[model samples]
Target: MKVFGFAGYSGSGKTTLIERLIPLLRARGLRVSLIKHTHHGFDIDKPGKDSFRFREAGATEVLLAGGQRWALMHELRDEPEPTLDDQLARLAAVDLVLVEGFRTTPIPKIEIHRPAAGHPLLHDKFPNIVAIASDTPLDVQLPQLDLNDPGQIAMFILKSVDLA
Candidate 1:
């Protein structure tokens, strides 16, 4: 399966763009999987939840299973985050894998850019960027897109990955 990514600094609309793109990608009948990267200490578990308790109790991993849904939380215990290949191996086969972070990797990516956020364009430094979804045009040879246009942006993503 092919992999595409959204990469940008914090609050550059990366998450928002992916949120809009998922439905459009799914509507095209393509199976999609997502990998979102988070920095620092973030928890999906509640303080008193069993998973939370398990981690606190020195269990390195916790898996909660249910009829309709299941979640597995693994505590690294100071271990490093898994590499991209490691993460990819865990995903089921699909038409595309849309990753939300992992900026320095070699995977092709579309950058979600909000000029007002005042962050430098990642394309300037990262050659992996295939396109830039932005609120304003930049004086670059790369393809430009309006960040508010999810339909168009999603289409660009699909095309960039040759999914179209």
Candidate 2:
């Protein structure tokens, strides 16, 4: 599967761009899987729920299922956080994997940049960034795409990854 990423500082519209692109990509008959990274601690299970109780009770992993859906939660009580590749291995095969973070990884990425966010462009520092999607035009040598145009952005991604 081809792996592409959207990397940027907080509030740079990475999630918004990805959200828009997913549908556009799917329209072209591509199955996409997304992996989003967050700095804050998060939980999918609520307090007092059986899954939550089982996890709190020292179950390393819990598989919760219903007729139509199932979710697997694994707790890393003492183990190191799994790497991106490890998490990717858990995903079923798809045409593309759109990663929302993990800026340091070597995978090719599009840097989502909002000039209003007042953050420096990541492409200036990361060689793995193959393109920049921004509200304002950038003077960089790499391709600069209009951030508001998800259709164009999706087309660019498909072309960049040679999946078109």
Candidate 3:
């Protein structure tokens, strides 16, 4: 699958943009999947749940299924964190994969930037960042997109990935 990424510091609206972009892309008849990275440890199974109990009992992996959907949780347990490639392999085939985070990975990315967030633009240092989406204009030579305009940003992403 073709892969594109969105990277930014906290509060830059990366998630919001992706949320908006998914339906637009789907409306164009493309299948999309997403892989999001989080620094904080997280769990989908709540404590006292059977899956949680199994995990607490040292199960290596747990699969939860129902009529509507299913999920698989694998335990790293002392293993090094999985690389972006490793995580990507877990996803089912799709036309495109939208990755959020994995900023250090070498991939075509659009950096979501908000000046009020007090974070510097990453495109300056990251050669893989092909565009910038911001709430305000920036002085860079690369393509600058309006952060508030999801339709325009969706077009930018479609063009960037050559799906336009």
Regions of model 3 farther than 4 Å from truth: none
Each model's lDDT comes to 0.87, 0.93, 0.92
Candidate 1, position 56, lDDT: 96
lDDT of 2 by residue, 138-164 (tens): 888999999999999999999989998
Error of 3 at 33 (Å): 0.6
lDDT of 3 by residue, 9-122 (tens): 998999999999999999999999999999999988999999999999999999999999999999999999999999889889998899999988999999999999899889
Instruction: Report the C-alpha displacement of residue 126, candidate 2, in angstroms.
Output: 1.5
Please list all clashing residue pairs in model 1, or write none if there are none.
none
User: In candidate 2, where is summed lDDT lowest over 10 consecutive residues?
Assistant: 117-126
Q: CA shift at 1, candidate 2, in angstroms? A: 0.8
lDDT of 1 by residue, 73-129 (tens): 888888988988889998889999999888888998988888888878779888999
Given candidate 3, what's the lDDT at residue 92?
A: 92
For model 1, the superposed segments whose C-alpha errors exceed 4 Å read none
TM-score of 1: 0.93
**What lDDT does candidate 3 reach at residue 119?**
90
